[model samples]
Target: MNNTHLHLVVNHLPIIFPVVGIILLVIGIFTKTEVSKRNSYFIFILGALASIAAMATGEGAEEGVENLPGVAESLIETHEEAAELFAGLSYILGGISTVALFASFRNYIFSKIMPFTVVLFALATLFFAQKAGTTGGEIRHTEISSTGTSQIIGEDIKKESNHHDKE
Candidate 1:
């Protein structure tokens, strides 16, 4: 409905993609399957695109949430800082995925380098994802919230989750 809403929708992709990509990449490496490796690259590239979308939407989301009851500006600021790092990592990893994709398709000369690049990108993605996840959790989960400025949203999440479990 809104930028924030769309952002929430797309935000899950970054988390999902890198996880799936890592699994695929590992499987590919173990099995020595070019196809699996290529698929992993494609997923990572999509994840990068999703990260861009999430970042763009995040600005509006931040604005929307900053003034909400129980929301703390300080926590939002911290989240913003982590988000910047996440976006940068996504772009870098995405770039690597693109190069890897091209190399895979063309049977290019950089075949040797692609594996190493993928490994690097995968590691970077994992780090960024952790940072992003922690920051995002702080948005509404008070106990986990590190902004040190906002009321905890942990109860809210717990209540909501409990309610869902009942259903």
Candidate 2:
């Protein structure tokens, strides 16, 4: 499949997988199950890898779509910025997940702290995830963008163009 196609398929994983992982982690914490914790860690790691894939394909996706009608560079820039934030947070989560996985295996003395730490990280990750998703959606979804909820950067050009057209 093309890079845009590949990106569409994998981009959601970073947004979705960590949510599932967070749930599993919470359950693991509540139930005191190493298996669940391990699984959560694995899921987070996968999410991180997927984030890399999505980031790698992003340029190709941009190249494929940036010139299309109604596709604003501002929207792309917004999405790109949000994506960078998401990716950085996701990588941190991945590192934490790996450490937590190992901690589960060895029953680390400070193991109790890891889950709480992950929970905090997940919350922040989730915030960025939502931002990325919304900005990315605005890239093409005019319905969402029409409400002036647009996070698109460089919007002045769009406004100026619209104003000129109306004259």
- RMSD of each predicted structure: 7.6, 4.4
lDDT of 1: 0.81
- Tell me the whole-model lDDT of each prediction, alpha carbons only: 0.81, 0.89
Model 1 worst lDDT window (10 residues)? 145-154
| Cα lDDT of model 1 by residue, 1-167, tens digit | 98778888998798789889888988887888889989999988898898888888999998778877777777778778887888788878878888898898899988657866796678777887888878887777767744443334465777789999999
Q: Which stretches of candidate 2 lie over 4 Å from their true place?
A: 147-167
**Model 2 C-alpha lDDT per residue in residues 77-159, reported as the tens digit of each score:** 98999999999999999999899889878998877788889878988899999999999888888778863344343476788
- Using TM-score as the measure, the top candidate is 2
Question: How many clashes in each candidate?
Answer: 4, 0
For model 2, what is the C-alpha lDDT against the true structure? 0.89
Q: What does the lDDT read for residue 125 in candidate 2?
A: 97
TM-scores for every predicted model: 0.83, 0.87
